[model samples]
Target: MDTHLKMIDFDFEKLRPIGLTQVVVNSLGAMQDTTPPGSRLMRIVETQRDWFTLHDGDAEHRARIAQRLVNVLQMQDSTVTVGDWAVVTEGGADDLWIAALLAPVTQIARRANDGRRQSLASNVDTALLTMGLDDDFNPRRVERYIAMVRAGDVAPVVVLTKSDIARDAQERIAMLRERLPASVPIVAVNGMSEHARTELMPWLHQGQTLVLLGSSGAGKSTLTNTLTGAFTQDTGGVRRGDGRGMHTTTARSMHLCPQGACIIDTPGLRTWRPDADGAALAAAFDDIETLARQCQFRDCRHQGEPGCAVQQHIAPDRLMNFRKLMRDAERSEQTPLERIAIRKKWKSLHKAGAVRARDKRR
Candidate 1:
C-alpha cells in the first residue's frame, strides 16, 4: 500500500485487514479516517444528529464508519469503544485481527467475561473544562469535571466562555482563582472575538490532546467551530432567560487543529458524576488539605474545634468553600460502604478531639 501524504486522504488498501489507524472526527454519526504517513489526526470537529463533520485534512467529511467500529468492537470488548487515537502498526493490527477472529464477535461482553478494559481515547494530555459566563457557570460543576479528568490521569484547564457578556468578568475570574489550584490555567474567552483565538493558541500546539466538557448551551460547540475556523457544527440558540442552548452537540468526536493539537469535544452533560475516589478531589483541593494539616486533630472537621488551625489561618469564606467541597465529595462518593466508612472515621476523630477539649477546660 502506498503511504498517503495527508491524514484524511488514506488509500483504502493501506488500511490493514485487522483495523485502520484513524481518529474519531465525528462520534455521533461514526465518521473516521485513516492517517497517512505524514499527516496527523485531531479530535472532535462537529456533531449533528447521527452524522458529524470531521476535519481530516483541510476538508471536513461526514461519515459514520468510526461509530460503527466502536459499536462492533465494544460488543466484543467494551473498552474497545470510541475516543482514542492509534498509530496503526503491523503487530497491533495482527492482535486486533485475532480479537476480531473470534466467532460471533460481540461489541460488549458480559460482566462475567474476562477482565478487559476499553478506553475512550488514548494519548490524551489535557481535558479543557469549558463553562459559559452566562447562567451555566457553576463552581460545583467545574469541580465535578476536574474530578473526572483527574481520574482519567489527564490534566484539567478551566476555560470560561462568553466573557464578553459578563459584566464582572474580573470578579468571576478572581473567585475561580481563589477556589481552584494555582497550577491550573483559567482562561476567559469570547468565542466571537479574535482575542479568544489568541488566548487559546498556545495550548493548541502539536502533540497535545484536549477534551472540551461542559453543560449544553455553554458554547462548547461554538468554541470547537471557532478553533477549526469554520461552521463545522450546527449552532443552537440559547434560551434568552436562562442562557442555556438546546443541546446542539450530541456525540463525542476528535479533530486535529491546524497547529497539530488534538481536541475531543463531547456532548453537553446534564449531570456529571465523578466515578472516582476522594483522592482526586483531594488533589483538586490541595489548599484544603494544607489547612486540615494545621488542625488540632488529625481529622478535624473545621466546624468549631477549639484549636482548629484551619479556622485560624484560612479566611472564613475560604473555609466555608472548603467545607462545601468536602460535603460535595461525600455526596459524590460512589459506594455506600465507602461513604459509611468515611463518615465513621471522621465522626470518631471529631468526637475524640471534642472530649479532649472538654477535659482540658475542666
Candidate 2:
C-alpha cells in the first residue's frame, strides 16, 4: 500500500459544495499524506453522543470515531464537533468510521461555568448571533456572544429575530449598533418569513458555513427552517413572563441552505462564559479599549480612576458589562493550580474572620 495518498485518486471535487475551499484543502498539508486505504473525506454535519452524521456533498452517512482516533482525542481532551472535516473509512458491514479529522480553520467555542472549554462549531466563516427583540433582548448577552465568536476568528453578525412581534426592534437595533463596532453587521428580521432569506443573503453565499448562537426562543431553528426552505429544525415559543425558550434545538446540526451555504443550528446556550484572555476580550470591545489608552493612568481600570476617559465617554451599562466580562475572562485564564491556591487563601481568610467573630461574641 502506498504511504502517500494520490491526490487524483481522491475526489476532492465532491467535497467542494459542502464548504470545501482550497484554503481548507491547503491547510490539510501533512494530513493528506496519511490517508488510510479506501477512505473518503467528509464533513461532519451533526455530532451526537457516540456518533456523527457526515456528508460528502452528495449523501449523508452515519459514523463513529475510530478507536485509534478516539484515543488521540481523549489524550488531547478534545471531541469532534459539527462543521469539522474528517477522514472516514467504511468498516465491515457498511459501518463508517472517522479515522482522523482535519484541523479547523476557525471554531466557535466558550468556557463553560464549570471551567471546561467547549467547542460549539468548527470551520465556521460567520456566526449569526441570534437574539430576540422581546424579553430576550439583551445587548450585554449579544456582546458576550460576539466576543466568543470573534475570539474564534469568525465574523459576528447580530441577527435580531422576532422582529415582527417586537415593537421596539428599531430601537434595539440602534442600541446594538451604538454598542457594537460599526464593522459588525446587524440585521433585523422575522425568522419565519421569506424576508429573512433575503436579508441574510450576504452571508449565505456558496461554500460558506454559518453558525447560529443565541439563547432559546431566539428563533435559531426558525431561521434555520427559513434558510433551508423547509422545517429542517423544530421551532418553539418562549415561556410567558420570563420569555425563556423551551430548548427546541436539542443538538447542534448542520443544514444546507437553498442559497448554497451551510448553517449550523446549535441548542440555546443557557450560560455562556467566553473562553478568551485579556487581549482577546479587549479586542472584542475595541471601543472601550480605545478609550482606555487615553486614560491618565497606565493601568486605569475605568472604575472612578482619575482622568478615566472610558468612564466619561462610554455608557455606564456598557462599561459595567465590559468590566464583568473582563473579570470572567481573567477567571477563565487561571490554571488549576492557580485556582486551588486562590481557593485555599480565601478559605484561610474566611476561617480567620469566623474565629474573630466567635471571639467577639464571647
Candidate 3:
C-alpha cells in the first residue's frame, strides 16, 4: 500500500489523528477498547454529507460514514465535522467505512436552532477568536464568542485583524486587553503580514491543532493563507455600510500549516448561541464572576440586591451582558414546550401591563 505521508517538520504537534503512523490495527466493528489489529486512526479534515476526508498528516483519503457505526445520534445538522479522528479499515474509495469516532480531547461547537450541535472543530488546542478592527468589531459579539470558547474548554486567543485600515486599532486592542482576562492572550495584526504568523506562534507549536473561529469576512481565511504561506482558502470583503464580511469560506476544512500546525477554517456565523452552563458563563466573565462572589447573599442575582457586589464593581453594560447570557443559557435548557409557554407568559404579562397603564391614564 502506498501510504503517502510527508514528514513536513518535527516542530508542529501531530498529536491528533491518533494513528498518523498509519500502522493499520483492526478494531472490532464497534467502538471497543481493544483493536483487532487492522484499523487505522484517521483524522477527519473535512466532511461532505455522508462522506469524509481523512488526513493522518501524511496522506489524505476519502471514506463514507458507516451505516451501522452508531444508533442514530441526534446530529441532524451534520454527522461529522473537521478534526474528528475515526477508526477505519483500509480499502478503496467505495470499500471503506468509518467504523467509529475517536473521542476528541476538545470540541468547539455552537447550538443549532433545532437543538443540535454544529461542530466547528474537534481536538483543537487553541481557538483563534478572529475579529476585524473595522466595521466587524463589536465587543458584545466578542463576549458571546468568549462564552462559546469557554463552553468548549479550549484556550481562547483574541486576534484583531486588519489593523492597518481600522480606525484606532491600537485603542481597540487596549480596550479588549482590559475587557478580557489578563491571562487570555490578545494580539492585533495585519492579516497579510508575517507578523500575524509570528504573533500566534506560541499556540502553533508542534503537534498542536488550531481552529479559526470568527464571523464571515473577518479575515480568517486570509490569516490561514498567511500562516500556511499559500492561497489555500478563498477570501472576501465585508459590506461597506455594516462592516460585515461575505462568507468566503463556506465549509469547515482542516489544513496543515507550513509552520507545522493543523488549522481548521470555518464559515462565517451570523448567529452563535453556545450550549453553556453556569460554569462556562462564569469562566468567560471571569472579572464579573469574581465580583459576584463578594455579594452579601450567596444567591445574589445582582439585581438591585442591597449589597450586590457584581453590580457595584462591574460596568452596567458588561453586567447587563452577563445577565443576558445567563438568561439565554437558562432558556436554552428548557424544552420546546417550556420555551413556548414562557413566551406566552411574557406576552400575557405585557398585555396586562398595557391595560393597567391605559386605565391609569383614565
Candidate 4:
C-alpha cells in the first residue's frame, strides 16, 4: 500500500498520525502472540461532579463518577474511587479512535452527609479553609473544616476574612495560631482589598485546586468574589443581632481564577461533621498530642490525672483547648462495628437495585 494511503487509513482509525504505523504493527504482533490484546485496548474513564453545582469539577465529581462506574460493574462505588485509575473496556469501536489520546484518569467521589465519604478533586495541591473574624469565627468550627480538608490528603491553609471588623486582629490570629498547628499558614485579610490577594498569591498557581470552607457570614463568598475580580456570586447581609451572614452560597462550585488556580466554593455549613479520626485530630492538635505523650498514663484524659504530662507542662487554657478538641473527635469517631453496619447497609441497597434491574429485564 502507498504511504499516503496508510496515513489516510490511520487518520480514519482516529489514532495519532505520528504513531499510526507502529500501533498497527504492534496490534498485529500482539494478536499473533499467545496472550490476548484486550488489556492494551481498554479505555480508562474520567468523570467529575461538584456538590455545590451540577457542573463538572466540583467535589461531587469524585462521588458521581465512582457511583456510575460501580453501577456499571455491579459493585460498590465507594470501594472503587476516582483516584485509583482503574482499567476499563471501551464500550464500542468509537472509543478506540480516541482511546490513545486519553490522559491519566482520576475519579472524585461526591460529598455525603450520612457518614464519612470521599470527595476528590483531581490535581488539587491545597485546600484553603476560610473564616471571617466577625460572628463567624469559631475555633471548634475551624478544627472541623481542617479535619475534612486533611481527610482528602490536601494541604490546609486557613484564611481569616474580614480582618477589618476585628478590634484586635493580631490577638485573634494569635489565638488561632495557638490552637492550630504551627505548620498551617494562617492569614487574616480584608477580602475586598488588594492586600488579601497579595497574601494569597503564592497558593494561586496554575493547576492547583483550593476549596473555601466556612460558616454563613464568614465572608467566603466575598473572598471568592474578590479573588475572581468579578461579582460572579451573590452576597447577603449578616444578621443584625449576630454578625453571622445568611446562607447565600447553596452549592459547591469550582471556578478558575485569573492567576490560573482552581477554587471550589461551598455553601456556609451550619454544622460540619468531620470525617477523620484520632490521627487527623492529633495532627490538627499536634501540641496537645506532644503534651499527652508526656502524661503519666498511656491514655491520659488530661483531667485531674496525677503526674499528667499534658497538665504538668501545658497551660490550663491550652489543656482545656486540647480536651475540648479530643471530646469533639471522640464524638465524631465511629466504632468499628458501626462502620461495618453502615457499609453493609449501603451494600444491601446496591444489591436491591441490581435485583430490581434483573427482574425488569426478565
Candidate 5:
C-alpha cells in the first residue's frame, strides 16, 4: 500500500464526530454562527507538553493551540490528548495554537497512581484487550480489563496472541467465554500472519479508532506491526524462563491501518487499578448480578444467608471475586475518615481470627 493512501485511512470527518458531543464546538460556537476560517478544527495525532501534532484529514502538521500565557481551561485541567478534537488558530508561516477543546463522546480513562483521572484517549470505538496465549494468559486480569473497558462504555474485543505456540488454546478460550460476557468477541491469532490481520479487519473498519491494552510481553506491539502493514512499533521477546516481557513500547502512539482505522498502541500497564462506580463493577459480573436481584435481602452480601440466590447458584470463587472487587471500589472512592474506620474494622476482625486459631491449637 502507498504511504499516502494509508494516511488517508485516518478519516477526520468520520472520526471527529465521535467523542464530539455537540454539532458546533470549540467554545467559539457561542460567539459565532459558524467556525471562522482562522479557527480550524483539527484532530490530535499526538500530544506533548508545549505543542501537539494534529491531523486535519488531508495532512499532518505540528501545531499548538495555547499562547504563552496560561489559560483558565488548562488551569482547570482540561488538557488535550491524542484523539482529542481542538480548534487551531492559523498564523503566518504555519504557526498554530489550540483555541478550544470540544467535549468527547467517549473517553478511556483510569485512576492514576496519585488517585487522579488519567484520560488515555477519546473517541475510540474499540478497546482491544491483547493477551499472549503463553505465560501472559490470565483469566482474572482479563476480567479486570473487561471491567475497565465496560466502565468507559467502549466495546471490548479479546485478542489472544501467539496462537502458533498456544497448546490447548481452545480450552483456555472456552474458559474465557464462560467467564466473560457473551457480547464480548474473542479472536485467537498468531501476530505475524496476514491471516490474523484479515481476521481483525472487521473491527478495523474505516473511521474507527482502536486502543491496544495489555501487560508487558503480551504481544501488543507485535500485533500492531501486523495491523499497520509495516514495522511501525518496536518489538521484543519475553524471557524464556518466566515468559515475562520487557517494556518495548514505552509511550502512547497512534498508527494508521491500511484498512482505514486508527490504532493506538499504549505502554504495558505495571499497575491497572481502575476507578469506577458501583454500576460499572456490576456490569463486568452480570451473571452474578442477575442472580443477586432474586435474593431475599436488598443488601444481600451473598454470604451463606437464607434465600441467598447468589450464594446458592454461583461458584464460591466467583462470588468471592465479586465481593473483593466491590471492596476495592469502595476503598478507592472512600474519604479519609471512612477509610480509617473500615481499616480499623478489618484489623479487629484479623485479631479475633488470630485468637481463634491459637485457641484451636491449644
Candidate 6:
C-alpha cells in the first residue's frame, strides 16, 4: 500500500452538486488530503448487495468496494450505505473501486428485528417522514419515526400525504400538533400534485440532503418524484382493504432535485426500531425526559409512581408509548445472558400466579 497519494489535477467544485459541504469537507481532513492515487471523490447514490452507484457530480458510475476497504468495514461493524461519500479509483475498464469511505456528518439508522443495526442513509440534513392521512396514519408510529430520525441528530418533518382525500385532515393535523413537539413541523400535502414541492421547499435548500422515510403507502416515492420534478421513483397505490400502500421502491436511491438538493427515497419500513440507547431515546423524547426529572423518586419509571410528573402532564398514550420504547431500548442494550435472566424472572412470576390460582380452585 502506498503511504503517499499521487497528486492529480482535481476540481473541488464537482463535489458540491452531490452535497459536498464545508462540514463534510472538513471531516475529510487527512482522508481527502491523502486520497489514493488515480482516485476521485464521489457520493454514493444507490446501494445494492455488492455494488454501489456513485455520483461524481457530473455522472453516475457503478462501483464495488475494494477488498481492503471491505475488510476494514467488517472490522468496524459497518457498511457503505447510500448518501456516503467515498474516494474511488478507476480499477480497470468498466471497473470502479471504492478505496476509502469518508465519515458522514449524520447517519439515519434503525434496529432490525434480528437485532442488527441497519444503516439507512448517511450525511442527511433532514428526514421527511411521510405518513398517509388515511388508514396508514398512526401518531404512535409517527413518534417512533421521529425518535429514529432525531436519534441520529437529523431534523424530522412530518409529511402527511393523501390529505385531499382524508376528510378529517385538519382534525388529524391538530391532534398531531398537540401531541408532538412544537419544533417539529407537520405539513399536509397531496403527493400527486406539484404543490408538494412548494410546501416542502424550506427543507430542500441548495446542497441540502433529505431522506424520505415511512411505511409503504405513505407516499414517499410519490413525494420523491414530485420534489425531483421527475418520475424518478415508482409509486404504488394502497390496498383498499387496509390502505397499506404497495411497496413500489425496493431499494434506497438518491435523486438530484432541480433545486440543487438531493433526495434519497427509501423503501417503506414495515418495522422501525430505533437503533439507540436509553440516553439517545430520552433525548428524542425530551418532553417526557424533562418531566421525569421532576418525579419524586430519582428512578421513577413513570408507571403510576407517586409524584410522577410525567403521568401528570403527558398524555396517557404518549406516556405508555414512551415507556414501551424505553423498555425496548433497555432490552436491546442488555447482554444475551441478562436478557435470558429477565425472561426467567417474568416466567417465574407468571408460574407463581398460576400456582396460586390452582390452589384457590382446589
**TM-score against truth, every candidate:** 0.64, 0.94, 0.86, 0.64, 0.83, 0.93
lDDT, candidate 4, 1-362, per-residue tens: 22222112212132211112232333433233332234222111133332111211222121122234445444332432222222222245423211121121222233346655444443345767888777677876776666556655678899998898776778888998877777889988999897788899999876455667677878888888888788877888789987877988775565667886656676776665454565765676677677777877897788898888777766686556556655656655767687788889999999999999999999
Alpha-carbon shift of residue 230 in model 3 (angstroms): 1.6
| Each model's total of backbone clashes | 23, 0, 15, 15, 6, 1
Global CA lDDT computed for model 5: 0.76
Best by TM-score: 2
Tens-digit per-residue lDDT, 1-362, candidate 6? 12223432234577676788878666655665566556777899999899899997788899999999999988876888999988888776769899888888899987778777789999999999999999998999989888878889999999999999997889998999999998899999999898998999898888899999999989999899899999898888989888888989999999999988999999989887777887887776889888888999999978778999999999999888887888888888888899899999999999999999999999
Candidate 2 C-alpha lDDT tens digits along 1-362: 22225531245566666898877777656775676667777899999999899997789999999888989987876779999988888888999899888888998777767776688999999999999999999998998888878888999999999899998788888888888889889999988899999999999998889999999899999999999998899889989889899999998999998788999999999888877787887788898888889999999978888999999989998888888888888888899999999999999999999999999999
For model 3, residues 224-316, the per-residue Cα lDDT tens digits are 999988999999898888777888887899887766688899988888776777667668888887887899999988889999988877778
> Model 1: how far is 108 from its true place, Å?
20
All candidates: CA RMSD (Å): 10.3, 2.6, 4.9, 13.2, 5.6, 3.0
Query: Whose TM-score is higher: candidate 3's or candidate 6's?
Result: 6
> Which whole-number lDDT from 0 to 100 does residue 13 have in model 4?
30
Candidate 6, which segments miss by more than 4 Å at Cα? Answer: 1-10, 32-35, 352-360
Candidate 3 has its poorest 10 consecutive residues by lDDT at 3-12
Better TM-score candidate (3, 4): 3
- Model 3 accuracy (lDDT, Cα): 0.76
Model 1, 1-362: lDDT tens digits are 34434333244332221122233222211222333233333222444555444333345444433444557766755432233332221223332111111121111111121223423344456777899877887876786577567666778789999899877788888998887778888999997676776888877876566678788888877887888676767777689897777988766666656666666767777754344456765676676677788787987888788889777776676566545655655565435678778889999999999999999999
Error of 3 at 191 (Å): 0.9
What range of 10 consecutive residues in model 4 has the weakest lDDT sum? 51-60
Q: What's the lDDT for all of these models? A: 0.59, 0.87, 0.76, 0.58, 0.76, 0.86
lDDT of 4: 0.58
Off by over 4 Å in 1: 1-82, 86-122, 312-362
